[model samples]
Target: GGTIHIGYFDQHSENLLDAMNESQRVIDYIKDVAEYVETADGTQISASQMLEKFLFPGNQQYAPVYKLSGGEKRRLFLLKVLMSAPNVLILDEPTNDLDVQTLAVLEEYLEEFNGCVIVVSHDRYFLDRTVDRIFAFEGVGNLRQYPGNYSLYIDYKEVEAATKKAVAVAEKSKETSVKPKKSERVSWDKNKQRKLSSKEKREYENLEKKITQLEAEKAKTENELYNAPPGEVSEVQKLHEKVESLEKEIDTATERWLELAEINS
Candidate 1:
């Protein structure tokens, strides 16, 4: 009944407002409960009729791109995706820019969809809702499959990675202690990575969790900032600084995690 594009954040392109034809198709379908809509097709909906009372719930109201709040723009783009009825949805980290309400709307819709849904997300909350299987890119140029939601997959994956890494480290220790042949390379390799050890695995998991929490907190702060009184210069300035700090934290955490992951790859 709907098309869901879950992929790298903002993959929906800026032309969303121009996809009028497809947008109309979606409007006609959801007409039973439709309140408002953005860019879709013209056949199914006129721009004037696109107005919806159901625009994103709470303070995170949906608006046209130029008029939208940051959160609203995020949801509007997602709404645009649903306008194109796709039988098989492709998602890449769909949770990245979503607010909780928007995320819930998507989760509800995807759960009711009749076709297959492939979600690529690092958000545990999202994966637990829409995915029943996990296709994880395990460390060290490996891909592994697990039959469970994100939480289970995380647990299983960390253990597997640790087992592999520890074994590799242990093997290196043995080679050095026993004195391997001169032709043999150093026991450790700058590029060679084993599975993560228990300690390392736990640390990685904690980092991931912290990132998720921080993102949520940052979103909440943004919502508050938008809802603050108009022309509240001091409050706006404070929020801007906080947002800047959050951005830095996000960049730092993401870089470190990728660095650790690349070691195994």
Candidate 2:
């Protein structure tokens, strides 16, 4: 059976080593904290190598986990989780205290991970980046499954609410049999969005493809950065810059596409 790993760090952990600086080095923490056998890939890896590759270079290699900043400790915990090589990862509020850079890197790692990931986070951006499915808790101990990322799910919900309002208005008009004036039909008026022009339609379609390409490129560049060797610092830096530029472009394109979609509605 596959293992389920919960990547939760107890802030108030009472273990003796957790209190002391026994795991004096981040490398030592990684080696001792998680249980694992050597990977079949036969790739020789050292703690120093992982530190450099994950952008935690120089002094960070030997820094004690207890002495590290909150962000650093979070990153270290994440590294330990990865080293454990579990088939399923369940992260509870994984974004707390993590810097933007670390978050981005972790998102990239999740994207390329071979196993399933179940993430619980209040960060909309993080949810949009890491998950395609969500289990939302409704009242009365019920859980609802929503398809797509957080942004897409939100859009779906808004459209659904508008549709329901329109239906309710129609049903009420049927029961009353009083033909309300145009201005009185508030729900209809509210949802009567503008239609798109031919040019706008074409632009929206093109943007969809372009945005997909950009996203794929961004993910690829992120993986490149994650897998970059210690000596390929320049290559990694260039890839990072490309990812940032691509993200901005994608965001602009996505926003324009959304605007066009609203008009098309």
Candidate 3:
């Protein structure tokens, strides 16, 4: 029954990107925090049970899944997964080749899944919408598990990484401000310690202040949502569509901190 769940590229030609994109869409829909799910009868459904009851109902097989443009293919692939009828789904990178419209459809289905879902994606915007938690791949051995969805993950991740970066900067400045730990006896150990002038001292203080303020601001924003209505309609619903914009601020700050770290290094 799941085999009828056709996931194919719309532009089924030599366009490797589209093909890969189609595959990713299907995979991402299966992740642990997914909102969509498959049932015992092999029926794909959402919280509203709209896919089988409406969108692709009445034996309405997917046309775009067989052949279409990159954008169209992505839509079909997502629909297929939404209807695959599984108890648990895992999706990885489901946004490739999707236009804003198709992405919306996929996001809606995800916002609709009910079972355990796990998704692997780098699309911050998509992640912010569809996921409840994040298993972000940081490096070869580091995959940070964030409590909230991607947006929250980004916020928390930035705090974690930025705080580390800010700490590094503070340490470097502290080191530069210190007189070389009483010059060593050996001539080879007599490396000169760079001294911070008065201006540098003031600048360092300003940086510290700015970092402290940013930390407080981030905390305020996060806490604000807790008291402000978390939305009675749905779990994935409260996060307004403007989440992408909100995340941008954090991203910008993270980048700045990273840049400062580079300068200090």
Candidate 4:
């Protein structure tokens, strides 16, 4: 989850291939090359079980580590990290070169894992599954905390942006003043009070309903994308496009709703 599982993120550590060069079978590689340690929860894992889980069974188990595919090596390395049982897992870009099956397995493992996971990733699907809270970097050393999954956080951000735009428009409207004509040399004050007309009230209600529907559609799309199999690239891409389109619709509807709401207030 989060592009990397707990204890699965170091890219440039002592090479996995180096360990491969020293070991024979996958089990031997794990037992002899990788560090074996107990988990923070005091759970101990068997090397054979780990080998079977991380790598394929039968011929692949007995195959030399050097003969394993790139994805296999990465998977094995991830198992090694998990075996170490670190209390805190800090990962950076763990999704590169990983197979979909492996990702599914890793996601399952993370779901069951009991440890602190610190992940820095742009994988929205992963973040949605893994993190309950997000610390979003807003540039220039600013960080904003949101108490929800990525999809909800994005919704919050969109609403916040719309609110800001509405406020700006409202403020700008107040800045306008009637310029006194040079010939008249005088001007009359006009009341700036605004209220929703009967027609406008209906429009406001309709806009609010449209905004709610768009938000629900976006959330549904996000959920579908998150649960979608990684192998279905085209389907995932389509869902992403749907989410983006819905966001735009929501933003526009929200802006109109805000304008009406402010006037009615």
Q: Compare the candidates by lDDT and give the number of the best one.
A: 4
What residue pairs clash in candidate 4, if any at all? none
lDDT of 2 by residue, 121-192 (tens): 899989988876667887999986655567655754554465456447544643564544877677544534
lDDT of 3 by residue, 1-265 (tens): 5533333333332344344433343223333225565644556545334443323432433332333455544454455445555446666565545667666766665565555566666778877677665566777989654445566555555555655675576567545743334453343232222344576556655665666676666566546443333222233333332333444554555555443433344
Q: What does candidate 3 score on TM?
A: 0.43
Evaluate residue 241 in candidate 4 and report its C-alpha lDDT on the 0 to 100 scale: 66
Candidates in descending TM-score order: 4, 2, 3, 1
TM-score winner: 4
lDDT of the structure predicted as candidate 4: 0.67
CA lDDT, every prediction?
A: 0.56, 0.65, 0.50, 0.67
Clash count of each predicted structure: 24, 0, 28, 0
- Candidate 4, residues 158-216: lDDT per residue as tens digits? 75576567557645644563354665343221212656789999999998788778767
Model 1: residue 34 alpha-carbon error in angstroms: 12
Per residue, candidate 1 scores C-alpha lDDT tens digits across 1-265 of 2444333235443344344333233333334334443322324543224324225433323222344555665565565555444555677666666767767767876765555677877678888777766667858999765555666556544544654564475446434544345554454453244666687677777878877887788788766655555334456557656755775676577556554554444
lDDT of 3 at 262: 35
Ten consecutive residues with minimal summed lDDT in candidate 2? Answer: 8-17
TM-score of each: 0.41, 0.58, 0.43, 0.60
List CA RMSD, all candidates. 18.5, 13.6, 13.2, 10.2
Q: Model 3 Cα displacement at 234 (Å)? A: 14
Candidate 2: where are CA atoms >4 Å away?
A: 1-23, 33-46, 179-265
